[model samples]
Target: MSTNPRGPNAIDRHVGSRVRLRRQLLNMSQEKLGEELGVTFQQVQKYERGANRIGAGRLWTLARVLDVPVSFFYEGVSETLNQPGFAEGDQTPIIDDFIQSADGVQLAQAFARIRDSKVRRRILELVRTLAAEEAEAQAAESEQA
Candidate 1:
Protein backbone atom coordinates (compact mmCIF):
# COMPACT_ATOMS: atom_id res chain seq x y z
CA MET A 1 0.00 0.00 0.00
CA SER A 2 1.13 3.56 -0.71
CA THR A 3 1.99 5.60 2.36
CA ASN A 4 1.19 9.23 3.06
CA PRO A 5 4.20 11.27 1.95
CA ARG A 6 2.99 14.34 3.81
CA GLY A 7 2.90 13.34 7.49
CA PRO A 8 1.14 11.24 10.20
CA ASN A 9 -0.73 8.06 9.32
CA ALA A 10 -4.14 7.04 10.66
CA ILE A 11 -2.75 5.75 13.95
CA ASP A 12 -0.81 8.92 14.53
CA ARG A 13 -3.85 11.07 13.85
CA HIS A 14 -6.02 8.93 16.11
CA VAL A 15 -3.51 9.13 18.92
CA GLY A 16 -3.15 12.86 18.45
CA SER A 17 -6.94 13.27 18.57
CA ARG A 18 -7.09 11.37 21.85
CA VAL A 19 -4.42 13.64 23.25
CA ARG A 20 -6.38 16.66 22.16
CA LEU A 21 -9.55 15.27 23.72
CA ARG A 22 -7.90 14.66 27.06
CA ARG A 23 -6.21 18.05 27.10
CA GLN A 24 -9.47 19.81 26.34
CA LEU A 25 -11.34 17.78 28.92
CA LEU A 26 -8.95 19.06 31.55
CA ASN A 27 -9.16 22.60 30.17
CA MET A 28 -5.41 22.58 29.73
CA SER A 29 -3.83 24.97 27.28
CA GLN A 30 -1.33 23.89 24.65
CA GLU A 31 1.15 26.37 26.13
CA LYS A 32 0.85 24.71 29.55
CA LEU A 33 1.29 21.26 28.06
CA GLY A 34 4.32 22.51 26.15
CA GLU A 35 5.85 23.80 29.38
CA GLU A 36 5.38 20.37 30.96
CA LEU A 37 6.85 18.59 27.92
CA GLY A 38 9.74 21.08 27.50
CA VAL A 39 8.50 21.97 24.03
CA THR A 40 6.98 25.01 22.40
CA PHE A 41 3.25 25.63 22.14
CA GLN A 42 3.65 25.40 18.37
CA GLN A 43 5.09 21.94 18.83
CA VAL A 44 2.11 20.93 20.94
CA GLN A 45 -0.15 22.29 18.18
CA LYS A 46 1.70 20.15 15.62
CA TYR A 47 1.28 17.07 17.79
CA GLU A 48 -2.45 17.70 18.22
CA ARG A 49 -2.93 18.34 14.50
CA GLY A 50 -0.98 15.18 13.59
CA ALA A 51 1.46 17.29 11.58
CA ASN A 52 4.26 15.70 13.61
CA ARG A 53 4.50 12.20 15.02
CA ILE A 54 5.12 11.86 18.75
CA GLY A 55 7.87 9.49 19.86
CA ALA A 56 7.40 6.87 22.57
CA GLY A 57 9.27 8.83 25.25
CA ARG A 58 7.30 11.97 24.53
CA LEU A 59 4.05 10.00 24.45
CA TRP A 60 4.81 8.69 27.91
CA THR A 61 5.47 12.20 29.19
CA LEU A 62 2.21 13.34 27.59
CA ALA A 63 0.24 10.62 29.35
CA ARG A 64 1.74 11.56 32.69
CA VAL A 65 1.11 15.25 32.15
CA LEU A 66 -2.40 14.63 30.87
CA ASP A 67 -3.17 12.37 33.85
CA VAL A 68 -4.04 9.37 31.68
CA PRO A 69 -2.44 6.01 31.08
CA VAL A 70 -0.28 5.43 27.98
CA SER A 71 -2.96 3.11 26.58
CA PHE A 72 -5.59 5.88 26.68
CA PHE A 73 -4.39 7.12 23.32
CA TYR A 74 -5.01 3.75 21.69
CA GLU A 75 -8.63 3.42 22.79
CA GLY A 76 -11.17 3.17 19.94
CA VAL A 77 -8.31 2.96 17.42
CA SER A 78 -9.39 -0.49 16.21
CA GLU A 79 -12.95 0.62 15.60
CA THR A 80 -11.77 3.77 13.84
CA LEU A 81 -9.45 1.79 11.57
CA ASN A 82 -12.27 -0.57 10.62
CA GLN A 83 -14.67 2.23 9.61
CA PRO A 84 -15.56 2.67 5.89
CA GLY A 85 -14.24 6.27 5.93
CA PHE A 86 -10.82 5.04 6.98
CA ALA A 87 -10.62 2.86 3.86
CA GLU A 88 -11.64 5.92 1.81
CA GLY A 89 -8.80 7.97 3.41
CA ASP A 90 -11.03 10.18 5.54
CA GLN A 91 -9.08 10.61 8.75
CA THR A 92 -11.40 12.93 10.65
CA PRO A 93 -14.11 11.23 12.71
CA ILE A 94 -17.41 13.17 12.77
CA ILE A 95 -17.87 12.88 16.56
CA ASP A 96 -14.32 13.92 17.20
CA ASP A 97 -14.66 16.83 14.84
CA PHE A 98 -17.67 18.03 16.76
CA ILE A 99 -16.18 17.40 20.20
CA GLN A 100 -13.04 19.27 19.24
CA SER A 101 -14.98 22.42 18.46
CA ALA A 102 -15.44 25.29 20.95
CA ASP A 103 -19.21 25.18 20.52
CA GLY A 104 -19.25 21.47 21.21
CA VAL A 105 -17.32 21.91 24.44
CA GLN A 106 -19.49 24.75 25.59
CA LEU A 107 -22.67 22.88 24.76
CA ALA A 108 -21.47 19.77 26.52
CA GLN A 109 -20.49 21.73 29.64
CA ALA A 110 -23.82 23.52 29.70
CA PHE A 111 -25.80 20.35 29.09
CA ALA A 112 -23.95 18.58 31.87
CA ARG A 113 -24.81 21.38 34.27
CA ILE A 114 -28.54 20.81 33.85
CA ARG A 115 -29.53 18.54 36.73
CA ASP A 116 -33.09 17.95 35.53
CA SER A 117 -33.25 14.89 33.33
CA LYS A 118 -36.56 15.94 31.74
CA VAL A 119 -35.10 19.35 30.86
CA ARG A 120 -32.06 17.70 29.36
CA ARG A 121 -34.26 15.46 27.23
CA ARG A 122 -36.21 18.47 26.00
CA ILE A 123 -33.01 20.23 25.09
CA LEU A 124 -31.81 17.15 23.23
CA GLU A 125 -35.09 17.00 21.36
CA LEU A 126 -34.75 20.69 20.47
CA VAL A 127 -31.28 20.13 19.07
CA ARG A 128 -32.48 17.13 17.07
CA THR A 129 -35.33 19.14 15.60
CA LEU A 130 -32.94 21.92 14.67
CA ALA A 131 -30.55 19.47 13.04
CA ALA A 132 -33.36 17.86 11.08
CA GLU A 133 -34.50 21.23 9.83
CA GLU A 134 -30.95 22.07 8.81
CA ALA A 135 -30.66 18.78 6.92
CA GLU A 136 -33.94 19.44 5.12
CA ALA A 137 -32.81 22.93 4.16
CA GLN A 138 -29.52 21.64 2.77
CA ALA A 139 -31.31 18.89 0.83
CA ALA A 140 -33.71 21.40 -0.68
CA GLU A 141 -30.88 23.73 -1.63
CA SER A 142 -28.97 20.89 -3.27
CA GLU A 143 -32.05 19.86 -5.24
CA GLN A 144 -32.54 23.41 -6.50
CA ALA A 145 -28.92 23.57 -7.57
Candidate 2:
Protein backbone atom coordinates (compact mmCIF):
# COMPACT_ATOMS: atom_id res chain seq x y z
CA MET A 1 0.00 0.00 0.00
CA SER A 2 1.31 3.42 -0.96
CA THR A 3 1.64 5.75 2.04
CA ASN A 4 1.12 8.96 0.11
CA PRO A 5 0.15 11.93 2.25
CA ARG A 6 -0.61 14.15 -0.73
CA GLY A 7 -4.22 12.99 -0.64
CA PRO A 8 -6.45 11.12 1.73
CA ASN A 9 -6.86 7.37 1.28
CA ALA A 10 -10.23 5.71 0.72
CA ILE A 11 -10.55 4.88 4.42
CA ASP A 12 -9.90 8.50 5.31
CA ARG A 13 -12.53 9.63 2.85
CA HIS A 14 -15.05 7.18 4.29
CA VAL A 15 -14.33 8.34 7.83
CA GLY A 16 -14.57 11.97 6.72
CA SER A 17 -17.88 11.25 5.01
CA ARG A 18 -19.20 9.72 8.21
CA VAL A 19 -18.14 12.84 10.07
CA ARG A 20 -19.91 15.07 7.58
CA LEU A 21 -23.03 12.92 7.73
CA ARG A 22 -23.23 13.03 11.52
CA ARG A 23 -22.60 16.78 11.57
CA GLN A 24 -25.31 17.39 8.98
CA LEU A 25 -27.75 15.14 10.84
CA LEU A 26 -27.32 17.37 13.86
CA ASN A 27 -27.63 20.47 11.61
CA MET A 28 -24.23 21.55 12.87
CA SER A 29 -22.34 23.91 10.59
CA GLN A 30 -18.70 23.49 9.65
CA GLU A 31 -17.83 26.65 11.52
CA LYS A 32 -19.38 25.32 14.73
CA LEU A 33 -17.55 22.05 14.43
CA GLY A 34 -14.27 23.79 13.69
CA GLU A 35 -14.76 26.07 16.64
CA GLU A 36 -15.29 23.12 18.93
CA LEU A 37 -12.18 21.40 17.54
CA GLY A 38 -10.03 24.55 17.66
CA VAL A 39 -9.55 24.51 13.91
CA THR A 40 -10.71 26.66 11.04
CA PHE A 41 -13.89 25.88 9.09
CA GLN A 42 -11.72 25.43 6.01
CA GLN A 43 -10.02 22.54 7.78
CA VAL A 44 -13.40 21.02 8.44
CA GLN A 45 -14.27 21.48 4.77
CA LYS A 46 -11.06 19.75 3.79
CA TYR A 47 -11.95 16.90 6.10
CA GLU A 48 -15.45 16.61 4.61
CA ARG A 49 -14.09 16.75 1.08
CA GLY A 50 -11.49 14.09 1.88
CA ALA A 51 -8.70 16.41 0.85
CA ASN A 52 -6.92 16.09 4.19
CA ARG A 53 -6.49 13.19 6.57
CA ILE A 54 -7.71 13.51 10.13
CA GLY A 55 -5.43 12.34 12.93
CA ALA A 56 -6.49 9.89 15.64
CA GLY A 57 -6.47 12.53 18.36
CA ARG A 58 -8.62 14.84 16.23
CA LEU A 59 -10.94 11.95 15.35
CA TRP A 60 -11.39 11.14 19.02
CA THR A 61 -12.17 14.80 19.69
CA LEU A 62 -14.64 14.80 16.81
CA ALA A 63 -16.38 11.70 18.15
CA ARG A 64 -16.76 13.39 21.51
CA VAL A 65 -18.00 16.68 20.00
CA LEU A 66 -20.37 14.85 17.68
CA ASP A 67 -21.70 12.77 20.56
CA VAL A 68 -21.10 9.48 18.75
CA PRO A 69 -18.94 6.46 19.33
CA VAL A 70 -15.64 6.23 17.44
CA SER A 71 -17.04 3.18 15.63
CA PHE A 72 -19.57 5.39 13.88
CA PHE A 73 -16.86 6.47 11.46
CA TYR A 74 -16.26 2.89 10.36
CA GLU A 75 -19.84 1.93 9.56
CA GLY A 76 -20.44 0.41 6.09
CA VAL A 77 -16.69 0.44 5.44
CA SER A 78 -16.70 -3.29 4.59
CA GLU A 79 -18.07 -2.37 1.17
CA THR A 80 -14.92 -0.39 0.45
CA LEU A 81 -12.50 -3.15 1.35
CA ASN A 82 -11.06 -5.70 -1.09
CA GLN A 83 -13.22 -8.83 -1.36
CA PRO A 84 -12.91 -12.05 -3.37
CA GLY A 85 -14.68 -12.69 -6.70
CA PHE A 86 -14.95 -8.96 -7.37
CA ALA A 87 -12.84 -5.94 -8.19
CA GLU A 88 -10.95 -4.76 -5.14
CA GLY A 89 -12.77 -1.99 -3.25
CA ASP A 90 -15.24 -1.62 -6.09
CA GLN A 91 -18.45 -2.20 -4.12
CA THR A 92 -20.91 0.68 -3.90
CA PRO A 93 -22.26 1.72 -0.51
CA ILE A 94 -25.61 2.70 -2.02
CA ILE A 95 -27.80 2.74 1.10
CA ASP A 96 -25.24 4.58 3.17
CA ASP A 97 -24.62 7.02 0.31
CA PHE A 98 -28.30 7.89 0.20
CA ILE A 99 -28.57 8.40 3.94
CA GLN A 100 -25.57 10.70 3.72
CA SER A 101 -27.01 12.99 1.06
CA ALA A 102 -28.90 16.15 1.91
CA ASP A 103 -32.02 15.24 -0.03
CA GLY A 104 -31.98 11.68 1.28
CA VAL A 105 -31.50 12.87 4.84
CA GLN A 106 -34.30 15.39 4.48
CA LEU A 107 -36.64 12.81 2.94
CA ALA A 108 -35.88 10.30 5.68
CA GLN A 109 -36.38 12.88 8.41
CA ALA A 110 -39.68 13.95 6.90
CA PHE A 111 -40.87 10.39 6.46
CA ALA A 112 -39.99 9.54 10.04
CA ARG A 113 -41.90 12.56 11.25
CA ILE A 114 -45.08 11.39 9.58
CA ARG A 115 -46.87 9.50 12.37
CA ASP A 116 -49.78 8.36 10.20
CA SER A 117 -49.31 5.03 8.45
CA LYS A 118 -51.81 5.91 5.70
CA VAL A 119 -50.01 9.14 4.95
CA ARG A 120 -46.69 7.36 4.69
CA ARG A 121 -48.20 4.76 2.34
CA ARG A 122 -49.76 7.48 0.22
CA ILE A 123 -46.43 9.29 0.01
CA LEU A 124 -44.68 6.12 -1.06
CA GLU A 125 -47.33 5.45 -3.70
CA LEU A 126 -47.04 8.99 -4.99
CA VAL A 127 -43.27 8.67 -5.30
CA ARG A 128 -43.61 5.30 -7.07
CA THR A 129 -46.09 6.75 -9.56
CA LEU A 130 -43.81 9.71 -10.26
CA ALA A 131 -40.79 7.45 -10.73
CA ALA A 132 -42.70 5.15 -13.08
CA GLU A 133 -43.95 8.06 -15.13
CA GLU A 134 -40.46 9.54 -15.33
CA ALA A 135 -39.00 6.21 -16.44
CA GLU A 136 -41.64 5.78 -19.14
CA ALA A 137 -41.02 9.30 -20.40
CA GLN A 138 -37.29 8.68 -20.62
CA ALA A 139 -37.85 5.41 -22.47
CA ALA A 140 -40.20 7.07 -24.93
CA GLU A 141 -37.70 9.84 -25.52
CA SER A 142 -34.97 7.29 -26.21
CA GLU A 143 -37.27 5.47 -28.65
CA GLN A 144 -37.99 8.74 -30.45
CA ALA A 145 -34.28 9.52 -30.59
lDDT of 1 at 96: 74
Q: What is the TM-score of each candidate against the true structure?
A: 0.83, 0.81
lDDT (C-alpha, whole model) for all candidates: 0.87, 0.88
Which tens-of-lDDT digit does each residue in 102-129 have in candidate 1?
6787788889999999999999999999
Lowest lDDT block of 10, candidate 2: 82-91
Stretches of model 2 off by over 4 angstroms after superposition:
1-6, 85-92
- Tens-digit lDDT track for model 2 on 1-145? 9777677888888888899989988999999999999999999999987788999999999999999999999886666554455664553766667876888888988899999999999999999999999999999999999
